[model samples]
Target: MGAVTPPDGFTFDGLVAKLAAHLRARGSLTDARWEEALRAVPRHLFAPAAAWFTSNHASAPRGRFALDDEPAAWWTAVYADTSVVLQTDDGAGDPLSGKGLFSSSVSAPGIVFPFLELLAPQKGDRILEIGTGSGWTAALLSWAAGANSVISIEVDPEMAARAAANLRKAGSAAQLVVGDGVKGWPEQAPFDRVHVTVGVSDIPMAWIEQTRPGGVIVLPWHAGGLVGHQLRLKVVNETTAVGRFHGTASYMMLREQRYNTRWSGHHHEAAHRSTTRISPRTFWDMDLGAQLLCIALVPRVSWYDVSEDGGDSLLLYELDDHAAEGSWAACDLKAGAAEAEVTQYGDRRLWDELSSAYRQWISLGRPGYDRFGLTVDPAGIQLWLDHPSARTWKMQT
Candidate 1:
């Protein structure tokens, strides 16, 4: 943002042309407006140390950590078409040592281009950006639509302030607010598009309430039980939303949405006959089921992880039904004169049923997420894979 010499070969115009070309080759970028936005905004001003994509360790820049002291190295790397770590573990680590949780980042140009395509912000539309990391995306929106058209919030004060400064330097002209984005700045309600950089588990009722009818909300959503399930979603109605998996991603869950890691003495132990007799791949997409379950059982339940000891058969791991405090594991086994075998503990049978549902979907023709669309109304939301085939998942009480 601040006027810095382009450092010889790094003229801003050259960077813009190169960025546009790189984006074009990725096939994820299409919007002309985005190119213009990239040209206008100064990426190097915000990025401290970008992760240099290279053939081997020697060529790749060592990231922000290495560039912290080396100003010229930092400047060149920051301008490249890559992501730079803006915060780690909430800004506790030195920007010089790459030791952090990557709390915030100026997403790689590859992602920024596609996401903007998915967002498709129109002129005069009010845009609400959830994670104001580096303020790069906000600057883009402000440049494309005008500064007054965008409202961005950051949960971390340091990141928020830096983003604000960057936007100011870029002359972005957008309103920057510091706070939890899940609350969706009510003051700027009815946003035409809401973009959340961080992933969330709960679909806040506030988001639905703030957006005007038909306004779109793009966000990353956590969808699974056990570890985590990341999915992108689009708001479709005042009370509902839907979307499909675009890519595998994991982010620090929202503060309020963070799951409890404590496993003992917290849930009820359910009675179940242990039985294991299935393929490990059968549970390939169990997290999808868990995601649907989370959307259904809000305020009370969520997926818990299950650990396992070597059982008498083939055993991997499983999810815990927190409401029931029950644990399950799939154990695999083999004997002198027998074939490969599997055993189940706790409620492993539930897993088989869950797997069967996915198998049925595959048999129906393993339709990718693209086919699945959303139809949301006051009554509820429907997952519309196809017309007439528009269906709704049962919301559990």
Candidate 2:
């Protein structure tokens, strides 16, 4: 086969320079070393020949753009500050034909640089990276901390093979392993840094065991809910890792740690009917910290909103696959209304729990995500306000 042609009037050096400038202007690509790496590595090399571009509003990719067919569009996407999906539904569906959940992707540069800034790996630091994705992150890590010092793990064999090939083509010698990320590569135990590209509900003890004391493990953490926060934890000891939320970012959940919920979808026969002084907009307009607090306080609840001629309302469902019992709550919130009507069913009153958590969040001065921190150990994780010892809530496994 002959070599593929680059986009007309496109140069690698010029594209990299533009991408670097874009990231720097956004305040994400602050580190000089990371910027240099971004300029050096070619993102298109790691992306698939045909990839899907994602946006905030769309459920699946808007559509797939092929390199050979739409070279200019493909080149633009590669350099854009948005995520490009590589695989969909675990490679089960045809991404080019239909819509499906993104399985793996080259993350947006905006989030990628923030993660690298939080990681702050040194020259010779040993790093273990989870969810290798398109190998772009591994290549960047190698460029920053030496290719020989990085070991990246991917659960899917196909993704692993592709990532390895991409790394080799980029001349990066970062070691790529095909295995479960949750088990964490114990063979390379006591790494100075561990970076997880996927979102996790729980902090695995294996990760703590594999990280050296005082080492940093940066991961996107959520409490079994839709929204997630970036956690930057430092291994305090063999059994403990403590850190605070730096910011919020949505990531593909770790395959092993993905949560599946069974909803009964019965909302008419609620046992209790009441009204709340809280407006429907309270939850709808909640900040990241308050949103996370709701998940922390009321575990295993999935929330959504419905629009109708009567009014806009929020629904909360208790997700228990084994029980499959009808436990749900709804709040009918009308515009300009002083109060909202709430109805609860089954054993758990989800709306009441959410309201209580929201009140507590307000009582705490409505702290942002940066004020909340987590401590993980064999005893389970603790979500605290302000500091580690201050008022804390024990997280459900």
What do the candidate models score in CA lDDT, each in turn? 0.59, 0.81
Name the top TM-score candidate: 2
Candidate 1 structure quality by residue, lDDT tens digits, 1-397: 2336665456778766876786687675688878877777877767654333211123334444334455456555554555676666676765445664556777767666666777778888898888888889888877766649999989888888888888877888888998878788998688878877776655676777777767777666553343333334556666765665454444556766554333333222443334344444334344443334333322223333232353233232332333344444333433331333433334334444444555556655665545544444455444445442465453322
Assess every candidate by TM-score: 0.73, 0.92
**lDDT by residue (tens digit), candidate 2, 1-397:** 0124466788777777877887787787887877778767778878788877765332323456778777777776677776888788899976565477678989988888899999999889999999999899998888889759999999999989989989988889899999988899999788999999998887889998999999999998866544678889999998999998887778988876665443455646646999987766567657878877777898878776676776778887765644556578888877667788998898889889988988988998888877788899999988888889998998875
**Candidate 2: residue 120 Cα off by (Å):** 0.5
- Model 2: lDDT to the true structure: 0.81
Candidate 2 lDDT at 141 equals: 89
- Candidate no. 2 TM-score: 0.92
True-structure RMSD, every candidate? 5.9, 2.7
CA error at residue 79 for candidate 2, angstroms: 0.6
